[model samples]
Target: MNRKRLEQILDVSLTMFREKGFDDTSVMDICNACGITKPTFYKYVNSKEELLRHYYDGALETLIQAMDEHEPSNDYVALIWIGLSMTASRSIDLGPDLLSKYMILNFHEHTVTARYSAGGKQRTVEAIRKAQEAGQIRNLCDPEKLFMALKNLSLGLTLKWIMTKGSFPFFSHYGRMVEDIILPDYDTVLKQTGVDHRKKTG
Candidate 1:
């Protein structure tokens, strides 16, 4: 497979998805935009849905970087909420129509959106574990469970946001979910006030 050609395909595909909407954009449309044949498009991925999933491959890394920006702070709780808000805002910027395609496939096949979007996020689990270790979040529930909570929160909120025709307040609602699910079991952890690391540039 030609990595350069594949990158070109993905770039064009993402642009088409953004401009034309994922449902309306056919594989032939992508091939035409990329100046590739059906066979050539197939050489890189099985289907257009598969190619869209590839876009999500970077979303995990994006979330990790968002979380890491607030690290080394005693207030892991705030950091987690900040990450959720940031990712939620990013999704809104990505547009709801594009994500709706994955949500549709996710219901039946349980593919990329099921795994990468929802379950089996080890990095997210590790972040939760760190907060748990620091007594910033409830330690009774395992980090794995907390990760699932995050995924569930994100998925549900995103779906609703899409269904509402972009009217839903995803960032605010997501923050509430994080506070309800991952916030401390006690009050002491909440008292760790610090700088708004979200504003920190480093």
Candidate 2:
């Protein structure tokens, strides 16, 4: 497949979905927007829902890349906070309606959403293991359980933010939750970890 052309199709489809809503947007609409024929569009993606999955999968890949670049001294807890904050900020950019649709799709088990979600959890588990090995994280609890709890909490908060139409300061509120609730020693470990969580770039 032509990588550039595929990206163009996904970008155009995302815009159309945002403006017209997923239910209203058709394959022909995306084809027209991208100056491509329906057959050409079909060659890239099988259906509109597939295009939506591509959008989410791409977004999660971007987050994983960001984490890899900024990973700090095996500090899994801090990394979790950074990922959650970044996701909240990105969701706000995508707009509440579109983000809600993405979240709803994410609940289904057979899409790229499920794959990305599982992949993210696996990455977090690895990070948690490293942190435990390095004595940065206490090993008293199961790493997998801890990671799942953190992931679920972040998702719930994000869903609540979307449901509220972005009225809440999700990024800042999440940061506070990390500091005060989830990781009370977040700042101290971050200092030791030598990772700047605030310097994420696009």
Which window of 10 residues has the lowest lDDT sum in candidate 1? 193-202
Instruction: Report the CA-based lDDT of candidate 1 relative to the real structure.
Output: 0.69
Q: For candidate 1, list the clashing residue pairs, or say none.
A: none
Candidate 2: regions farther than 4 A off: 59-61, 72-77, 83-93, 106-112, 129-140, 190-202
TM-score of each: 0.73, 0.74
Candidate 1 displacement at residue 99 in angstroms: 1.6
> What is the Cα-based lDDT of residue 181 in candidate 1?
78
lDDT of 2: 0.67
lDDT of 1 by residue, 67-106 (tens): 6666666566665665455445545766788777767766
Weakest 10 consecutive residues of candidate 2 by summed lDDT: 107-116
